[model samples]
Target: MYGPIADTIRTQRLVLEPLEVHHAEEMAPVLDDPRLHRYIGGEPLTLDELRARYAHLAAGPAPFHQEYWLNWIVRRVRDGQAVGYVQATVTPAAPEFTVASASAGATVTPGPPRLVASVAWVIGMPYQGFGFATEAARALLDRLAAHGLRDVVATVHPDNRASATVASRIGLRPTGETRDGETVWRLPRRAAPT
Candidate 1:
């Protein structure tokens, strides 16, 4: 839904490679630990399941929604191994409420869809505490901004403190909203400094 699909994002210590079905084979093992699914739920996906899932994502988002499902496999630069992933679900934001409700002193209502992106990140258990997730996520957010996205959001389970921290580090603030049992974090776009 943006330009030529999601491009590969590079960071100081890692690379966010555009996700492909073949990457699933390597990613399966990186994501194999059961603990990695503690908050996301479900056991680790088998190679086949991951491949199928990647295939669907690689095909792009559904036409009806006009959403862009962007995904990437995070690989460590030193070892060149897949260790995690970062993704963004990009869609137009509601255009009706152009101003903040607080500023208007009245509740704002939805209008035509305008551009927003929802992002998520996950790193293999062993990769935790190394800032790989943060680096990859920061790079992903940069890419989204380059595509002219002004609103970005992330949903994290309340119990998933690690993810919440990562979200905060990337400038998302808790909106005190929950969806399907996950806290919603939002980063309103800021004007670039001159």
Candidate 2:
């Protein structure tokens, strides 16, 4: 019932504001380029469709999954232009503690699960190669770590070299594991300051 929520995260050149339905308008143009979807294999969504999608993302995950859906709109601090977004889906990795009944010492109840997060970022075509994605992703991860959700992973298409480089720059290395047709990269437990 308890989990991490998205916060407005700021970096040296960008600010990651928690995603809202209103962000769809600005995000539409940023995501309009077809080249951006070359690897992902999807065309850009219309503004209206983006609005609906944003609405869904803002609502967080369904109750049954016990997940924390944290999404943020990445924008430039200089001009407040929305460039893209970053997101993390957090779920319990393991139980953090256990409580034993006072009268029945043998009865043990597990406390909350130690959360693990899967992170991802998208920087619009125009924003690509500007280091915004890297900076924004670092900020996201740092915030998660501060809240004890340092176990992070990212899935990248094996053919997307740029994204792979960004993942490595953020201290994640591929474990040669594939999930849902994407490569899984994990971060070290003790993340080094980058």
Candidate 3:
């Protein structure tokens, strides 16, 4: 129906729009705060750099790549202010069998591939204390779920309590796992409510 899944995700106060290179102009200043990068590492990207990065992100992965890169610009509903962005890199975890093959000796064939995603979100320094990140992350995860992606995870820096709290608020629990030094949080696949 819609052009992309992100186009259909919105919360009470925020709307997720498909990321565009033109968004870099407004987002660059919002993301320019050095403090915001404390946990994520690296300083702010320049306008030019952000534009280039956004352009590349708008272009999907190379052909034959197994990952689906979904990105969106998080905007405030009231004023359409670009607060930050949310992204998920989804890849097939494993194939699930849909039907039994020949019971005698034939190998059972699997059905569609199941998807797993690693998600991330960022809100500007000016908007950090207002719970926008939590709202946006929830919307992202909800869209992921609606898209049939049940295995979702987020990596938060150990020292970034703010991010860890957001992850927790979104039903993700620390998995006791670390990747690239950041703690991994996961929301196990649960049966959907009837």
Residue 19 error, candidate 3, Å:
0.2
lDDT of 2: 0.87
Where is model 3 more than 4 Å wrong at Cα?
A: 1-3, 95-112, 191-194
Name the TM-score of candidate 3: 0.88
lDDT of 1 at 155: 94
Residue 113 of candidate 3: its Cα lDDT?
A: 66
Per-model RMSD to reference: 4.4, 4.9, 2.9
Regions more than 4 Å wrong, model 2: 1-5, 94-112, 190-194
- Select the stronger candidate by lDDT from 1 and 2: 2
lDDT of 2 by residue, 81-122 (tens): 999999999887877566566764666677755678999999
Show how many residue pairs clash in every candidate, following the order shown: 3, 0, 0
Per-model CA lDDT versus the true structure = 0.87, 0.87, 0.89
Q: Provide TM-scores for the models.
A: 0.87, 0.85, 0.88
Q: Judged by lDDT relative to the true structure, which candidate is superior, 2 or 3?
A: 3
Q: What TM-score, to 2 decimals, does candidate 2 have?
A: 0.85
Best-fitting candidate, scored by lDDT: 3
Ranking by TM-score: 3, 1, 2
lDDT of 1 by residue, 1-194 (tens): 54554777778899888889999889999999999999988999989999999999988866787688899999999989888999998877656564455754966566656678889999999889999888888998888777677699999999999999999999999997999899999996686679
Compute the lDDT of residue 128 as modeled in candidate 2: 93
Worst 10 residues of 2 by lDDT: 1-10
